[model samples]
Target: MIKVVSKIMINSSAKQVWNVISEIQRDPYFWKGMSRVRTTSKNGNALTRQVTLANSEKCLQKVILFPIEGIHIRWTRGMITGTKDIMITQIGTQTLLEVEMNYELHGIAQVRSRSISEELRDEAELAVHLVKEEIEKTQAFPTESRKQWADMIHE
Candidate 1:
């Protein structure tokens, strides 16, 4: 198993940060190298999406475990399996958002020349920065977003 973790502080509230990161539909905008995301299926908290990478490779990812009020989501498909955890702490009006991705390479894909762990680490860090920028740029946290935050809080 391989793990890569990245942490960042965003100038927003925990509820504000949660609203952005929890919505998978807007993922491509925040994560570089991700071209698109198409929702394939949804069952309760589980959502399956087809993700297109920048290299044009497509992968099906099943978000199997996601609690409405929780900070983590577990997903897996093919040789990749992982959990993305978003830890939020409010400092006045700002939020300290820590996103951690823990993934493992399986099967033949595990036999790679370059370090897959290193690549994942870089990607994870980039994801954190991108998320921060997206939130700051949009200045999100509208009524609907606040509703989602409220739902998550209630859960």
Candidate 2:
């Protein structure tokens, strides 16, 4: 199994960050190398999407863990046994977003996965960077009223 962790600190409230990322359907617009994600099926909190990569390859990605309303989102790709966990935390006036990704590559996929591991890591960093840049540029929550941290997380 291969694991990668990426983090970024955004100059926005956690609530604001969660509001933007909770909508997994919009990931293609922000995440590098991801061209599109189309929902294929949904059952309660579980979701499956047909994901098209920037390279024109496509695969099925399943939502093993959905966004907990205002907390985090997690998904897995069966093709590569890949899993990703996106978590957000509030730190004073800023928000910390972290993504933990793990993938088990078998047979030929192992070579491909290893060869592109750096690129994969870079993509993760780039995604969060884009999020931070966009959020800071828009100041989407400039006027967000201060709420108890717990309240925001559970809201």
Candidate 3:
């Protein structure tokens, strides 16, 4: 088994960040290599989306959503691909996003000289970077009234 973890700090609130990540079905452009994303099931945050890569390669992925925390997804085009866990936490006034992925290579080594573990780590890092960039581009949420009110001190 191989494990890859990446983290990024974004100048945004956790709720604001969650809004973008939670809308996986609505925004296909946020994905790195995906050209198109079709939702198989969309019942709130938990969804099944079919992603088509630029090279026309397609894969079905299971997307699970978490409040202001993060999103989790699993995909397997072939062999034992892996699952990605994206966790979001509030650090000071910014949001910290962390991603972790685990995968295992299958079949014989002679046939496939390339290391799937290394590839998985690189891909996971790239994916997290893309997600951070996408979240940074969002200007939708400026501030939440709930958060603002909670931050105030009554005299």
Candidate 4:
């Protein structure tokens, strides 16, 4: 099995970070190469989804949500057989987001594992970078409490 791990530290609370990423349906937005995603079925915290990649290859995945902790995704069908685990941790005032992908390439992909590893790593990094940007961007604007506090201090 080929494994890839990517991590990013976001300047936001773990709750804020989880609020953005916990929505698994938004994968196509953060995951650049993913063309589309649709949940096929839901059983409480576990759901099945049909994901289509930019290359038009489709895969069936089972995703399990773990609230503010992390996510577990297993690709059940397609040329790739794998499981991706996303872990969230808080250190100081920042949130540490980590993605661990363990997958095996079938058919012709086995021979190209070396190159595929780099590609997966790149994708994973970009995805977390985008999420960090999103969370930071939102935090850039002051909320009601901050704004009110600033106004009172000025007054």
> TM-scores across all candidates?
0.70, 0.76, 0.68, 0.87
lDDT of 1 by residue, 52-111 (tens): 866576667766434323355555664556777767777797877776777776665589
Ranking by lDDT: 4, 2, 3, 1
The window of 10 residues in a row where model 3 has the poorest summed lDDT is 104-113
Pairs in steric clash, model 2: none
Higher-lDDT candidate of 2 and 3: 2
Per-residue lDDT of model 2, residues 43-65, tens digit only: 87677788887876676777744
The reply for model 4, stretches above 4 Å from the true place, is: 142-155
Off by over 4 Å in 2: 64-78, 106-108, 140-155
Model 2 shows how many backbone clashes? 0
Would you list the C-alpha lDDT of every candidate in the order shown? 0.71, 0.75, 0.72, 0.90
Candidate closest to the true structure, highest TM-score: 4
Question: Which model scores highest in lDDT?
Answer: 4
Where does model 3 exceed 4 Å of error? 26-30, 76-80, 105-119, 137-155
| RMSD (Å) per prediction | 11.5, 10.5, 8.7, 4.3
- What value does the lDDT take at residue 21 in candidate 4? 92
lDDT of 3: 0.72
Error of 2 at 41 (Å): 1.7
Clashes of 4: 0
Q: List clashing residue pairs in candidate 1.
A: none
